[model samples]
Target: MIRTLVISISSLFLCLFFTACVRDTDFDQAEDISLSPIMELDLIYFNLQASDFYDTINGTPILTLRDTTEIKFLDDSTLQESLKRADFYFKFTNSIPRSFQVDFEFLSEENNITYETGTAVEQGEVSTPVITEFTHIVEGEAISQLTLANKVVVSVTIPSSNENLQGTLNMKSKTTYFLEY
Candidate 1:
């Protein structure tokens, strides 16, 4: 009986020792994630023709325009621009009966940048999207910025002949960049 008890205790100690020495190869600290949400989206006209119809932009009626642009990030904090205007298209039915507003957090910057291809990230790229939506009354078009660590989603709550709002438009590239200080 005593020999059996000693064997059992030794086995328990061996098990504990093995567990303590085990290495967690799969365990890792969570890396920082940057999600930029495009807020302050406006539903208005672009230059001459609306963005919805500029390219092969034909769809169900939509309330918002058809152009979408999001900056790419070098890291979670800094961002870089690859394309100035990302081609975005939206379509909707003329049957919806409710109105809606969209909001996205943007990067913080003092000035709003005018979009140009091969240009540096604009000030607005650092801002969050303001709350804006399409109504019976169309207004000037504006989408401020995409916030870090936020995913921007667009929705149309209105329905009309101009209802060319497209499906979910995501950023073409990761805008936020990181550089060790």
Candidate 2:
């Protein structure tokens, strides 16, 4: 008798489970989905001493110093397609007594300049450091030119320098990217 009762209940539950209603799912809604992500990355940093701008052997000052850094990720096809906007930030801490000009040149693989920007750093004393900040935003048509760059050249220009020049000039920079797909 117990066995028959157990079998009856099991049959009834199975019948009810199979008869439950579920709403229809529309897979086409997935087509309207999109993703947007923002990313920030460190671009470059450098520290230069006063002596770096002076030529000890030649007994003259080197007015400018340039450094090149590869930015190959900007050339990626995926990044080029999804990147909607980009912003570059540079911060300069100057303890040197001479004002300077800093330039950023974005170049393509063929050494062509795609974009160029710069900032002027104010003169400061060794006892008191001066901070200067600069921002460059690329959107709309400018984004196209930025995507073509595979390298960046940084040039620091000083007005004058001597063996007795004292203090340092430091820089920190970063880039923020906005992407949508």
Candidate 2 ranges beyond 4 A from true positions = 1-26
Best by lDDT: 2
* Candidate 1 local Cα displacement, residue 47, angstroms: 16
Off by over 4 Å in 1: 18-24, 28-87, 90-112, 116-181
Clashing pairs in 2: none
What is the lDDT for 25 in model 2?
A: 77
Clashes of each: 43, 0
Q: Residue-wise lDDT of candidate 2 within 27-81, one digit each (tens)?
A: 7889977789999999999999999999999999999999999999997888888
lDDT of 2: 0.93
Cα lDDT tens digits for candidate 1, 40-108: 333222221223322345544455443333433311343222212222322222211233333222223
Candidate that scores best on TM-score: 2
